[model samples]
Target: GEEVAQTPKHLVRGEGQKAKLYCAPIKGHSYVFWYQQVLKNEFKFLISFQNENVFDETGMPKERFSAKCLPNSPCSLEIQATKLEDSAVYFCASSQLGPTSIGYTFGSGTRLTVV
Candidate 1:
């Protein structure tokens, strides 16, 4: 498909459990970003990776959130010991990473529920 692909449309976990989401970028995109939408329409940028390296992750919560982007593999975002506040829709986007990168191609997102 031409669009980014995210797996496991909906995931439910108990508080303190682990949550992992996967994202496959478009074939030629080299930069990937992860966003968290906690409220109805509010989104927060979490992290971004360029190819196999971390590009910027300033928005990631220091302790619980970690992400990876590996060559030939789908990118992933994992939360260690998830908290109730971790419940949200996670969106993945991909871009070419250059002047031509005007915007991102976003995935449908994965809804993560923590109870």
Candidate 2:
């Protein structure tokens, strides 16, 4: 019940298809974090909350990319017209006391494959 939960362990999408992933953080957690691990084993920060900041515009936040951490629902990351470069493992981690807090729970993550 305290662990972060992510749906659809794997996703397959064609280029230009929409890809939407969901992450349910530990209930009552105030902050959520999303990251993308590219093929090179480098992690790219996608977005995070409670302030909801997009770390890198070049990596994401394109017109087709969006993320949200809403109350009463799991946080979501959506990419419209996904490109082949979008294929990566997306991670969602939640914090109890904002980013400053050391305690964070991370989900196993969702693997997205674009062809």
TM-score of each candidate? 0.95, 0.87
Query: Tens digits of per-residue lDDT for model 2 on 1-115?
Result: 7999997789999999999999999887778888898765688876677734443345566688888776678889999999998899999898888776788888999999999
Tell me the lDDT of model 1 at 112: 100
Model 2 lDDT at residue 22: 96
Candidate 1, residues 43-115: lDDT per residue as tens digits? 9999988898998899999798999998889999999999999999999999986423876899999999999
| Clashes by residue pair, model 1 | none
Q: For each of the candidates, give the backbone clash count.
A: 0, 0
Query: What are the lDDT figures for the candidates, one per model?
Result: 0.92, 0.83
Query: Could you say which candidate leads in lDDT?
Result: 1
